[model samples]
Target: MMMRIIYPILGMVMAFTSVLHAQSARITALPLQKELKLPASFETAVEKIQYDLLENENGESRIEVVDENCLHIQFIFSTDKAVKQDDWQVSVTPAFSPSFHWAPHLTPTDRHIIDQHVFRSPALIMADGRQVITLIPDLDIMKKGTPVRWYLDLDAEGNRLVLGMSNSRVDDHVLFVREPGAEYPAGEVEIGFYLMVNRDEPSLKNPFRRPLEFLWKRWGHGLYQDGNPVDADLERYVEHTYNWAFNSWAENVWQEFELNGNKVGAPVFIVNYTQSPNYPGEVNEREFRSVWNQAWFSSLRSAGGLYRYAKRTGNTDLMEKALLTKELALSFPQVEGFFYGLIGTEMHEVEIDGKKYNRSKGWDTHYWGNSNRNPYTWNAAESPFHILDMSWTALLMLRWYDELEKDERLLRYAEQYAGSLLGIQSESGFFPGWLDLHTLQPMAHLNESPETSMSATFLLKLYELTGKQEYKEVGLKAIDAIIRDVIPSGRWEDFETYWSCSRYGSDYLVGKKVARNDMYKQNNFSMFWTAEALLESYRLTGDRRYLEWGQRTLDEMLMTQASWQPPYMYVNVLGGFGVLNADGEWNDSRQSLFSELILQYGKLLDSDEYNERGWAALKASFVMMYSPLNPVTKAQWEKVYPFFGKEDYGFMMENYGHGGRTNAEGEGMGEFTIYDWGNGAAAEAYNRILDKFGKIK
Candidate 1:
């Protein structure tokens, strides 16, 4: 390897030349065009560089690059014997608007600098949107065999981008490049990266998809078990799930009365649940009682489950319950007049057994709770209105109106929710992750996040149902924002739980200094949700470009999933997904949602290839469910956890703690809470699957 490094630099001083033909162009020796800023210490250190074609039409193919657009470069560092230390980084300018992971071009903010990482897939899409240039480091050379911790860098201004190989690490979503006494190494170090320019038009294939496909085929496919004794018995898993729903989870509606000091003219559906005593932690007593005001938790998720089950079995009584569940969901505390559609993003205490309790009050004390933005105010103006809450609720209403009933009231509610979104849409056509309920102004630096596709999804759904021109126009614009901004650099952040950043909600309103904790970088749920939205865009418009973008995003999202089981103790984890950055960590709460969306992509595209992968993902979703029938996994759970000795059909573990800081270094089998995001969401996914595919044999 050392001898191989010497040959590339033999002609390092050759003059750069561009060879052009009628149809093709090539650069024989690449020149540094941008005024890249590097540390003086690194500049002073003795070094040499080697530039060559990494690959052309045919060569040693480590990565695919167009013969004309590929360039290989290597940097050799000797030593800095002076013992002086300084933070090291190199920066280059991006020539594109709506740049991602680079400083956000349209909405420049401090937040953009926080999400820098090795996996960001740093790239710059040209303004014409027809071509993209990607900078990919040779990971094996940079990190596997070396002490280098390579990370990307982006300044708050749109002018600078960096690929930092030294004195950098993104800790707790903050970029920390300054290390005390950090100096150049003593030995020869070689750093290498590839630059490939590819056509980004709809007709051309995405260049980034190749590596992800290689990973999935080489590692991801082999890890999954065909007949795992977990939830792979989809027939039984679906049956027992619905059985738990109708029997233990469902609530009936009675006459209007003063229950728990609030007038309930309509039926109330309870979706909240307690932290299982079997799990580690001091269980909250209040969590045993259902709480109101949460969009995903209180009713919407479970309503979908019941509605689908009713439709499957033609159970009129269950159908009425589903309708009532949706009604209770819509009746949550909402903003009036100008923000008429904004719903409460905080949980309100509910009376259970004649005592009021806030289920989510003490949740922040748990390890998983750090992801939630808790202790938020109830004030409409100060509290941040989570877009997903309104998006999901509006989508449910529209779906119900279209499929179940033509009730004009449902249409009115959908219009109000989506119309409010239009009022707050950024000039870029994306909605902020959070907005002040009163002023409709963006909170924190959330206006530029790419995951606002959650809102675009609902708008497109409404457009499909009503053929509303305004809805179609705004929805397509948001889709355009996604393609122009999100696809170039995969900065999929700001898709945290609804209550995230609530702890600093007041600080954001008062213009006080607050830590940049709102950005949830590389969250899988956000990516999956965005993929579904892109598919919806493609479905409504018959645009293959949307399909192309959606496929690329899903390939990126797959990196979050466990391609292989860790050699950890306890439960099966082959098919689970890790939350942001913990690539090997297994099992997240959004498995079912991922399964559902991927399955939809397969169905819509009529691609048997994706359908096969989708089924595998669906099977993966149930691996976390503790089933009495699957005694193999149950015993395994008991061996490490001892908590799963008590089986609960409706309860699915959110994160298995197999790998990641999501738990105590992946010590236990699961996290503490068994809330709606897990159980209710899984139920909703399974219900959707059952309705569409029929008994999942």
Candidate 2:
């Protein structure tokens, strides 16, 4: 009898162990459910048994459940007074779907899913003529292992409210509302139940906790993973180049200047020429000089500050630099509450001192000047394009101000700049690509130019902050105008011609003579701008077409690089250049490769392969430019008479040929470029990438 009993117990233990092993092997699995819902009014007499309720001594309410197939909820409220009819709102969030794995810092065993909406009320006019908003979920159709809860917030006076809900299978939800020193007619509000569910479960932690890890799971991320280490050599080169450009010998110069309080007339000025445009053998010496001087002292100070910030404390330094830059930039007199681009010259100059300079002398006279002879310049004041550039700079300042939290002046200036730009809007709900600086009239002839796209992007950001419908409308209209005029008309070939014409309103400029269109088949910058615009619009509107176009353009750009070698990748300390063909061949003597790599890196947060390729390209170009010794110096020197007298292109280019050796032997000893645009772009790219991929919490 004892042997038989022992045998039965042993069999039972073996069976239990087998069951545990089976469950462990499938730990990531979740129950599949068709749907779940909670009616807007919980008035429906439906029966579901998946809940428990508990009442505390303090009159607080708690709801609990432990089912994989259903969510349970309960409500408790004070019965001291009659409830107000329409003073409360209900909200329910369904479990997030786990289509992808959790990010690095998150636990894979925890719930992870996308939040889905169930119900929202239409604009409801209250009896008192006030608008009340509300939403609900249908609980019966929720997915398996989903968490459901209800929220109640009083729009009017409420002394105290306490509510809590949790599920053994999911995370907890809590709501607390308190209004002190307020009295209202004694009333009680009926608490109702609302349920919501998606095909997946909601995550217990914040979604953005692991951006890079999540990014790696996306289709693009997988491609990047496969290609990354294979391009390790290139990555090393890029990282080395970036280090030299932003953190090496050049950085030492900046640090020395900073140590001296950025005093004027330092030896650093010798390296300043690199910040200006370099055009070889050009007869127009004056033009070249003008371009070089355009890198004003103030701009250099700001750029240097930014570089320091990037290399040091990312946030603290950035905040300080942003404030300083804004203060300095705004100190310049405004033509019409806008800073001028250049000094002394009416052409390309927005303003000088307090006087309104002649707009006719600029690139487009009528847009920015008082002259009617050149309608192109007439919209200078309302040039959304120019305004957009300022806005971008201001936005950067604003972001830093938000980080610092102590400087009110920086925040105030940023808002002032943004508001001034917004004031230029026309009656037709359109922001002209160009504006008449004198009259503030829309330069309608410029068409829905690239400014339309860029402005839309900025407006969207503004809308998020301000919650103003006008901003949203303006942003949507700009996007719509572009889609209607530019894309549908097949004017992709006319990449440079401004499409907003007075007669045609905003239409495609199919046959306009713009050098951007004539020289290159596609303006690479425009494509990037448009891509960002479309993606941002899609984020706001959930319009698939915007996403589709963005993805298509992005894919095209990425795939094109597979075939061709980038030309003169060492030009312009910054990454990127103008005009890339479908095959990835680029033109333009001056290439901003640093900007290109950084820009592409920003986009790579969403794509794995693109990110990998971007890193590879960035590494290759960076190493080639900043390596200690110029490997090609001897090769190029052999071509010159008396090889000992050969020019060191790398050293000369990096140091602006100032205080640098010109012979191959002195290659690694040259001074680094100081206060150059390349440094700024590199700093910006590094910070941006670090923000996206760094492990900091």
Candidate 3:
């Protein structure tokens, strides 16, 4: 690279960014070409070069070569900077890009690949295998965590590419793109990102495996004596997330809510179970449960989190919370016949489409999963019916009845819930994501994500409890259906990187081979469950193919883990989100589950290969902790007080690596978030691992 310099604090230069085998150098860029156009309010005098445009003219766009070595391009969108809403798009190509093979949506059947604008992280993958990844790190899907998103697409062709981001203007979430046909008034919006082009050996493939392994060895997190690969461990992280989230869970337990002018005390619940501290100038409070019905999994997620943690650790206090959470889940309204679920809360009045709808006034909005962010007008017909919630809720109840205290108060509900799941199974083993809330029948559109695998694992567990042959049959059928979609070779290979399961299969319902819109793409939830199904199938059915499939998928996942060592270990790859976004963003939702599954399979299969890789992956969860290295700034800090904890000592962050630069709102950079999703999963994974293996030293 250029002349090496020591970090002001570290006191020494550590050849941190050097590429051993690759001939890449990020030298101090040469003097900019005189013809290069810059942003309106741009300023940079020190080592780094920066440009800014508070407001922009219509049709105004600029691209400049900032670094000749990496062929880095500066992408800018000209618009009014005062507009606080996110509505802008930016895309720039490296010097040698040709066409794009945008990844295929992860549908189980009739998967279609395309050459269109992609999400979260945008990158230019050269035909020769070189990849130039564009990063808008601050615009992560999670408002608090680093953001990574998929654009609906402004341009489908390779001539242009646009990335997606939420709160681009309001919170300085940079990578920005608007919904298809959704227009913004001519206004101010500042969105920018960095493009890194290098032959750093795209990590997941067979030939590209060296770089990821190399990164961990050289750059892995080490606050201890030596920065060994082992130091990027999962044991400590499990404790961090589990303990913190448990406290929050306990604190938010509302004993009652005012319903019909009466204080009800039956269903104990958490208010801030899935919210981040609101940023400054943001009026949204994170603790309102408005459209939670769309993402019913939130309740099950919290309960399951507490339950798993309590089960793993035998914590009496947590056990009480777990039981209470589940008891509240039992109180959730369910539709007859097929057994649909609800948000376990009331819906207040909301206005939409000139009509008032059931909703509650709150700040809850959608980021990921098919949930109505707008509680006022959230229509069930327009949203996804999350079956995974039903599955987990049943599992929670069953465990309460069978494994834990054997409480029959919840057992009747558990039996009915599990029975409903069985009744809804398609004779052909198909389960659509969008289903009729009442009949448990396929809704208008039959989904393609084929959540057969996800449901299969839950059913298998029920079969063990009741020894029901029908449950076993349904579970086996689901697994078989999932195995049918396994693309044997090529890019998808052993793992479902490009195509597998999804959170929504509504695209298939519309006869669209690709997703037109979404809750989340390339979901980690689907990936983890699929792998778990494979392993569980092996254990229950003694199918060696299932075992091999699980091993192969985990092996590929280990290779694809995108992580950074040292000063940047927080973004290190943790087999967390296998979204396989070429731009290298880490979405840690359910990541710990994937890691935990890998660990379980490793131990049972007696495969040290899986065991070692799994721990490294799980330990990487701890590596996700927030530190002083994040981009969240002082002005943003003023926006969130009681919410933001010790700046240096923080919780797990997900969907990161996209925020290499952009800051919070008008501030310099945004801070990392403390997501309950990451925390809950971390706690559960931690407890289970500790219960079985004891604490790692």
Candidate 4:
């Protein structure tokens, strides 16, 4: 094919251009420094920040500071400044909390300008080996004026990179201070700069089969503090999840409710680990997103996961609970075309530029389309249209129903849902994000959506279940739509094909302190049946493009795969910053099927590297789901959220460490955020992988 030929030629050209540019580029590493001062009115209670006392420290080093938050401040004193101000042109390491080495869209844009004193989040730049490193200032500290001021000297030498910070040579270094307050803690800050030297510059898009040991060694951190030997034990993971499930059963995460007066057991997973009626704040009201106070489509995921485990280990205690998931699909309210949700329609208003567009929208996330009238402030930004979750749930129902053939009613439900999905198929393979349930008019669809279509697999299932060529036809058409977007175009490259609802990928989000998506463009969520959909299509259709696109996504994901090391669990492969944020830093998920997709990739590619990596990912997911000490210590987790058959897991301040977005409101992420659905999916994947491919020793 022309693609096979043209791809290499393009790569070679880019490489040659990069080499030429590198050769001609003069590296003038300017010395950078800034005095960062915290204001007096700083909040007392904060996230993971630590301060420690030095042992028998001298007068200057022993500045007594008392603060509630942990300020594990590491210091590199002024006396021991490595790169002096005079010879600072060689390189400059920055002083700040070392996070993921994100792309330094390191340009300075002055927002908080006090008169002529513009507050610049001077992105501290350093040259480490061949890679140019940008030390991003954490969001908490970018606003304090001249103290946050940083300027550099690079204009004299062709102005390659640092002109954004300074037009003229001001200071080759930066000074930092955590200004004085009762809570701010009076202290002489001994600024320290940590350099994340490049050990291996693996191309972000290629090289799929590298060992995780290297990834752990270079990127992973802190899994052995308690001296617990690291073990990627699938059995152990399953056991821990089993305990979690049984505990939740006792807490009544699974409840009996009346739907259509049939007395259906809710058998659902609550969206938040801390979902309580008493709690009503931005973190609470807004955070409890998924069908609060009841169960919905997503609730099926955990049950599906549980079913997978039961089949794997021959445990049938939870079989009833798992089977109860049939209610999810069965109870869905049939609407104009297909099954919309379990509830009726509600009005959704989006006010853009002061114009309100209010329409009766079909339910997607909240329970059965019923808001449950849970008290909270609502906004247009809280868009309620998730095609992927519904698609996955529908597909899951069909798969389970067909595989078992136990419940004929559920089969009817699945068939109805499938036909409904057919009704909404867009000409361009576009699944409208929001739909006016009454009119059934396309209100809007998210371009490069975070939701992946189940059309291909669902169609195959429909064809198998009913022998319908039309279903297959629609499925192929949907696949075409996806392949069109996934394959690199003249406007976008293959790299951007790790595409989401937004056209602008993570590459554009580098250096931005606040992760926001006001532009509302193309974005992506990895765990959304994205790669799996294509690979599954490839399996059925034998379409090389499906595999190629799937492989392309897998390889590009290799690029975003964390630089985090061990004991530092909690990677949000599920696409973080919540429902609206298609892509953003720090991800957490309850989509249990992510690992299964990885397992499928390994088998399809026949690549040991993928198998190994997939296993590692599953293991890490297990740890994130079960390990109490990952981001929160056992004591901390147990104190607030006692794990009594209740799993304590969430994003855990593991923001960019797991996932990020170009434009996200915030990490609607928190601690002890475990969902049984994801647990089930994880368990299912773990079992399948274990049975298919034993531990890679």
Best by TM-score: 1
What TM-score does model 3 achieve against the real structure?
Answer: 0.56
Model 1, range 1-697, lDDT digits (tens) per residue?
A: 0111111111223324222111111322223212222233322211222222211111121222223444454454445342233333334343343222221111123322222222322232222244444444544464234444444444424344444444433233222333344344455555555544444463134544544444344444554434431444565666665555555433321213332353432222233223343445433343222333233343555566767777778889767766665555555544531222222223457576676655432212211011123225534334466665567667777777876668787788778777678887889888876666557566665566665787788888888887888988898898789788766555565534223421212233222211222112344666776788888888888888888889878766765554443333245554455555323235666666687676777677685535555665566566666577656455545554555433355445565542322222334455333435555556667777777777554
- Model 3 agreement with the true structure over 1-697: per-residue lDDT tens digits: 0221111101112212221111112321232222222332121101122222222332222233334212222222334433333333344333343232233222121112111212222222222244433322222222233222223232223323333333321111222222223233343333333333334443212222232333333333221124322353344455545454444332332333433343322212122313333322322223223222112224444455566666656788766655555554555555562333443333356555566544334213212223332111254334445565556556656655664467676666766766766766666675655454435466543344434566777778777877888877888888776666531221221112222222133223223323222212333345456677778778888878777666555543443443332122233343334353222244444455566676686678686545555665555454445433222322234343434554223344444443322223422122333343444445555655665566654
The list of candidate 1 runs beyond 4 A from truth reads 1-205, 222-225, 228-231, 242-283, 286-298, 314-321, 337-382, 439-444, 495-520, 582-585, 604-609, 629-633, 639-647, 658-666, 671-675, 695-697
lDDT tens digits by residue: candidate 4, 109-162: 222111101111122222323333322222222222212122222111221222
Regarding TM-score, does 2 or 4 come out ahead?
4
User: Which prediction has the highest lDDT against the true structure?
Assistant: 1
Which candidate order results from sorting by lDDT in descending order? 1, 3, 4, 2
Error of 1 at 663 (Å): 11
Count of backbone clashes, every candidate in sequence: 2, 62, 36, 62
Candidate 4 worst ten-residue window by lDDT = 1-10
- TM-score on alpha carbons, each prediction: 0.62, 0.44, 0.56, 0.56
Q: Model 1 residue 36 lDDT?
A: 25
The alpha-carbon deviation from the true structure for residue 610 of candidate 4, after best TM-score superposition, in angstroms, is 1.5
Model 1 is weakest, by summed lDDT over 10 consecutive residues, at 1-10
Candidate 1 clash total? 2
- What is each predicted model's overall lDDT from 0 to 1? 0.49, 0.32, 0.41, 0.38
